[model samples]
Target: MTCFPVVCEVESVMLEMQDPKTGVKSQPQRLVITTIPHAITGEDIVAWLTNCYSIEAEEAWALGTMLVAFGYIYPLQDHKRLVIKPDASLYRFQTPYFWPAQQWPVEDTDYAIYLAKRNIRKKGTLELYEQVQYNSLHKWMNHKWDFIVMQAKEQYRAGKERKKPDRVVFDCQERAYWVVHRPPPGTVSAMDYGLERMVDPNTEELLFSCLFSLFSSLVKYSVTYNKHDPFLAPCLPSNPWVTDDVTYWLLNMANVEIPTKMRVERWTFSFGELLSDPRGRDDFRLFLKKEFSGENLAFWEACEDLKWGTAATMNDKAQQVYKTFLTRGAPRWINIDGKTMEVTVKGLKHPHRYVLDAAQTHIFMLMKKDSFGRYLKSPVFKDTQKRAILTTVENAQSKMGIIILKRRPSISPIIVRQLEQEERARMATSGPVDITQVMSKLSNKGKEVPPSKK
Candidate 1:
């Protein structure tokens, strides 16, 4: 799998932060319970980021929090909150082995082993989340519970031999890693790639209901789109491939002045389908104009252009979008919620292609929910539907005579050469042949054959 670019960049920054001479100063720091060696305060981390990148303190703090959240830097004291405190709270650069760029699979067996070791150390005093996971894993891996305990015991014994400071630091490092990976329930994990399930799979009833719902949705979708699917339904007029007619292609051109009845029918299938077709979007734009909310569609289209357009003009286009639609008192202002506005405005300060995503999504949902439904009911759609062209086989045949299905045959040169050689041999053999020559040829064939085995 391809690695995320941010992960690679974070790893590089981490390497610079680990430089002995130019890195954040570290020394033995006393925690509430113990003294951890080579620990740096959270203030030092934020300051180092600000000075190194020449950014504002807020941006530096955000970057530092990202580093901590991604498991590159782990807090030595407050392992629960993974953010730079901008104070004297102790933190440390995580060992490279535990960095997320390693792409290690956070497995249950490894977590079980760690929990078992912690159980032994704390004497059954693991935290609430850890305790819950331990019980679940125990039930799941009951067959190999004994083996897990044995491995955990061996690891704990080995850890006992390490120096006091080293052991404490390692313990804190491992704990921080797990806290990021298996965060308390209800909290979003930074390591999550958005594919995590929302419902528990172990509940049979819920799982069956989810499966049934998904199957129902599939059936409904197939039924709704059955006629629109070209492979499932015959193309109007005639299939271009089979009939060798270009009329179908001409009629279905993306920006055709007037779409066919079938194409207009497809627009009602979904909002996405309507927006995907140029003609449909034009019709939607017309409806939005009548409603005085055309800026929403304009902003959505600008965002799409920014996302897919050339990278060289990305920053300029982002600025243009902000000035045109997002800025207060702008000509074409779009309405979005305050929270989304804050996020979009803050992200625009360090603008990339997706800086306007939150606002764009908010507008897209607004249009989809409110404007899209109205557009279907509005006379604009009905007018377009009424004016849509209807082409039939008879009309096509009358306009452009019966399309002859031409079959063009292609022959390989090698086959032609082989046939030529066979013909030459046939011509040579067509004439009378000498019996002595035939005998000599048979003798040659016999000589060419290998001697028979004994």
Candidate 2:
């Protein structure tokens, strides 16, 4: 189990109290028999609480006492009574490890071990309550009583090596922790949640039924909308991100003149989908107007505007909405139950953005259950469905034609430059040509001068 909210809040206060400068003053206060280091007086604790929270002395004292009862601060002198004295009674902040917010279970085994350890140190001179518990636990755990005693002996021996003051402080801290957790009989335990401790035999069956219902609902919803999910199902024509074809987006624009077959079909998924899409809302609004119940949609739209509109215009818009749709004999008045009307009117006395939320929800359900189903079966929906554009294979092929060209990789510039240099070197190595001989050969191209030349 987690710590209660009150325990968590007290832990934060305790943290602030432990601060060096602003927290309660501490010193080596000498108790009647022992000198305890860094112990705070009760007066200082109450004063600190008053100053920190700006509360009255009485309230601060109550808060301090509560902290003590919860084991955040432990009294050194009077360990039996767990309350702030508002005087010079020495108290110390309990270690964070022992704070109630740590959610440590107050188990009998642990308490038995603590009592056994205390009995060993005090030579069996345990307090009356501790002795009673010790005896009971000893008898109940008779099988493991020897092991418990052996563990207590080890802990007692380890404490002997610590300094006298440190050992005394630790023993007091441990005693205080047990006293708070296992309080005397007839005293209420702060940790107890009465009636919650009882277990119901049918709880497991109820839990399994709830889990099955939740799982079945989730599976049904996913299956119903699986084909409409953009990630799971491909967009028709093509996905713009992959093919750079924007026809899909154009066909599904929020207020498109004509919605696609798939877009029109999505309005049947849920009432929320119809309201979310501008085109779908327009179709629904038209149907409502034909039924002479358009005021419901208008009122719902006004509420949505008020919800998302700027804060500066919130009150003015709220007043306008109330006067137009909610007031007696208003032009666009919508029907709502008497209780919802009373709540809305009372809230409008000092209007906020959500003043019409109850009425809006009422009108929404009215339209969804009555008008929405009729609209789906009426001529309006069927006409739209018939006019809804379908993406054909030929249209997609035509749009994809521009993207079908095959591209060849070009030669590198560095390779081209190297080839040019090699051609120039070959021409240079062949040396210069005889211009006169080259001209004569060109002039006597068809003449046979090979024999004379040889």
Deviation of model 1 at 440, angstroms: 39
- Model 1: CA > 4 A from native: 1-215, 391-401, 404-454
Q: Among all windows of ten consecutive residues in candidate 1, which has the lowest summed lDDT? A: 193-202
> What lDDT tens digits, residue by residue, belong to model 1 across residues 280-301?
9999999999999899999999
All candidates: TM-score = 0.46, 0.45
Supply the TM-score for candidate 1.
0.46
lDDT per residue (tens digit) for residues 1-454 in model 2: 3334556678788888999988888999887777889999999999999998999999999999988987889998898888999998899999999976566677888889899998998899998888898999998876455556766877899999988888889988998888887888777766554312222334666567667899999889788777677766666776687676788889888889999887888899889989999999999988888989999999999999988899999889989988998899999988887767866777777766666777888999998898889999999999999999987556667666664443235699999999999999998779987889889988889676566654
lDDT of 2: 0.83
What is the number of backbone collisions in each predicted candidate, taken in the order shown? 0, 0
Which candidate should be chosen as best, given lDDT against the real structure?
A: 1
As for model 2, its CA RMSD to the true structure in angstroms is: 24.3
